[model samples]
Target chain A: MPSAPSDSLRLRVDVPDRVAPGDPVPITFRVHNVTDRTLTLYLMGRDIAFDVVVERTDGATVWRRLEGEVVQAILRLESLTPGEALVLEATWDQQSGAGSPVAPGEYRVRAELLTEGDPLLSPAAPLRIAPR
Target chain B: MKSMALSVRLLTAATVLVLAACQDAPQPLAPEVSAASVGADRASDALREVMALDRTVFGGQDAAGQLVIGVENAGVASGVRNVMERFGIAPSGYRIEITEPIHFATETLRTVHRPTRGGIQIHFSNYLCTLGFNVDHAGGRSFITNSHCTAQQGSIDGVAYYQPTSSTDPNPIAHEADDPAYFKGGECSRGKVCRYSDAARALYQTGIDSNAEIAKTTKGVNSGDLAVNGAFEVTSQDNSSTTFSGTVNKVGRTTGWTAGNVTDSCVTVNVSGSNIQLLCQTLVENASTQIVGSGDSGSPVFTTDGTNANLIGILWGGNSSGTLFVFSPFKAIQDELGTLNALTDGTGTGGSDGGGDGGGDCTPRGNSGNCH
Candidate 1:
């Protein structure tokens, strides 16, 4: 069965400014649409072309995660029309590439819609990872 | 070295001029000592320069219409004074307080917080919120934060608060402080943002580790100072408005310890699109950068006499950027929520020691959430 249409279209991301080291942070991606035309977004294993990157103010890439770690199968393709909001969530456990806990500082977390060639990057969200 | 020699000579010349002018006015003391240094037009210009070049200091006008500067100690104070002097501005009628000294390689005071005060973590379900302050209210020991975090619409007594869901030690140090087995008392109330207040009251277990200390240190562990000395009555006693201008430091789960200036005191803010206006907000200027942020609700914003945490307000909400942090007045919380007592105001007893280490089962940094 096909889904219905929406009314508005807007993409937004929600992130926690503070994290307790080992606790995973949940970053929510919301897609709101308000119109008659239907917008299709591909969902590969439930991840809709989502990518979260945590960088220092110097633009140094500290942590990186892509949608569905190495997608194995296609989950479902969804369509968002006018006035409908689509949401997807990803969790980052406050760790770096060295598998070490990221030190406390000001970090910029950016989530993007890279499902297609042209990617829409959300304004970098300021997140602070404080001590437990 | 050359600057000091120049300042001393300049200050001597300026003092003679100011004293001569006031000598005949019957005013023995010069309140505006630095008037001659920077008249009126050059004052603002001098301030902008300090904001841009002075690294160790953050200066602003206090509510009492006085210039206030936050610094690490006397060392930076000399440099700041010299810089201002260069612009022909004397620091008369200016209040220069101290900030945590930046001594080490690390900047974030991650482990530089007191469990019961600012920079604490309180968990309800899977979410975590920062604690505003620990006080004794209504004859019961309680810790406060945003109502949205503790009360959350349908929050009941014993909703439970994990002093922190995370532990610094290998063994967890955070425990359910509100459980019957613990502090056994909790109050959660969710009021409309602007209409009322968004504050929660979580009663503590008698044995729960609690204190009125604020993280005054900008470094690690207890190596720096973080304690609450005195507080202001932002409700009935508004005479201390000047002190509020010095709204400098805040310890939160996310931002650790950040100091800045509160530009606007009373404001009605519409948080997000909630339609509800958050009343009585203390605006932390974007110029001061990120002082509050997500998951920092209920965190305590305060000032320090280098060692004491002078109570200010409890954080509520901010803009999407988290730069425009909004807070509810402490007096408003006392009036609406109805319970609050400082653990060590020479009054109620929540903690045994002042500026001392946190209690048993926890080390200097505190137990990891699992109970060390």
Candidate 2:
């Protein structure tokens, strides 16, 4: 007998208006359970693959992920029953010294959600920064 | 039998839970519409209805009560066209007219006002929302446009100038200061002095890239330029009222003014062209009814329905597809004029036949012109 689908699984992230170069951008992901059965949820930032690029308003561009380690933090939900929610947090630091200093201007942050053997889900957010 | 019954109950509950979870997630809200995509056919009808409604409610009153001046002569039209063409506005698809003229007299002069040899008009190529105005400050009177319009002092009307500051500053210092960041071309306009307003600074809080999304959502009909003629006056101290929350009727040159509802509080729209990018903000009105079209730039946007129906915004640019357009808040412009110390007591009451100088008084252009 096959098990049923899990409708309780969901994800969300929070972002800010601006960030400085080398500053840490804190991102929070939440998983909620809407079903009655307990679920074993395995969530890892590394499991997802997406492109990240930062550019100035003038067309100059740089690859954000290439300059620094693609840091990942693991989050596990041993058992989440119906109406339960879990939180996962991670920080993306604009690693300095490896690449040119991110110029001052409007920048874009893109994140894609993916699963093994599944199509990718990508959503992008923009942030403005006043360089120090 | 009892144990089997219990097991079956548990399975059923589990199945129900799984099915519920499998249901689709809530969809995100639909993006707003652009003024361009509203379609010419629908916009024309909406414009007619708004005009009819305005006459019935206001008792056949013109925009004069609202302190709007009409630009209607060939000299005015020719001058405006020259300005538009020099700014790279394609003349084939769009029309430019100076429906009014500026009248000045020697008796009204409290201070000697000399016409500077070098006066340049700032142009935003990509973004249609940006507008041009004259700025009066301690140093002198200068033309103003979006910082993104020009990089450094480029010649306009034989005047030498420089990019002073970015419009995004919250508390921008009026006089030019030493900051390489302030002098960048993409961030500042080239003129005698680049200036930004408090409203523009506040608008910068909203993300700029979001403007593209906003424009994509509220498009208007036709791809060419539009013109709007109406006067906007400050009715209250809290210039914050600059963003009026109400239904408004807009009258423009091409698809004469129409009526619509404002949706957002203060929206910043970026109009991008090959040579210029202008960022402007205005009260976002979402009207199930259409009200404006191309060649309506400079149209006045106001509400005749509410007590606050005073002058609110000046039509600058919009997206036809999403039924959304951007205007400069009247308060912002008023405040800019005030900051420059240009609004003289006499100039306030003076009547001129020049563009934007006619104040809010309305005179009919066509014989027995019916507003409706």
Docking class of 2: incorrect
Residue B358 accuracy (lDDT) in model 1: 12
Q: Fnat of the models, one by one?
A: 0.00, 0.00
Score each candidate by Cα lDDT: 0.50, 0.32
Best by TM-score: 1
Poorest lDDT segment (10 consecutive residues) of candidate 1 chain B: B179-188
- Model 2 chain B poorest 10 in a row by lDDT: B209-218
Q: Local error of candidate 2 at B272, Å?
A: 2.4
Q: Top lDDT: which candidate number? A: 1
Worst 10 residues of 2 chain A by lDDT: A68-77
TM-score of chain A of each: 0.75, 0.49
Alpha-carbon error at B44 in model 1, in Å?
64
Interface RMSD computed for candidate 2 is what? 22.8
lDDT of 2 at B101: 24
Model 1, B40-64: lDDT tens per residue? Answer: 5566666666566454545666555
Q: Considering every candidate listed, which one attains the maximal DockQ?
A: 1
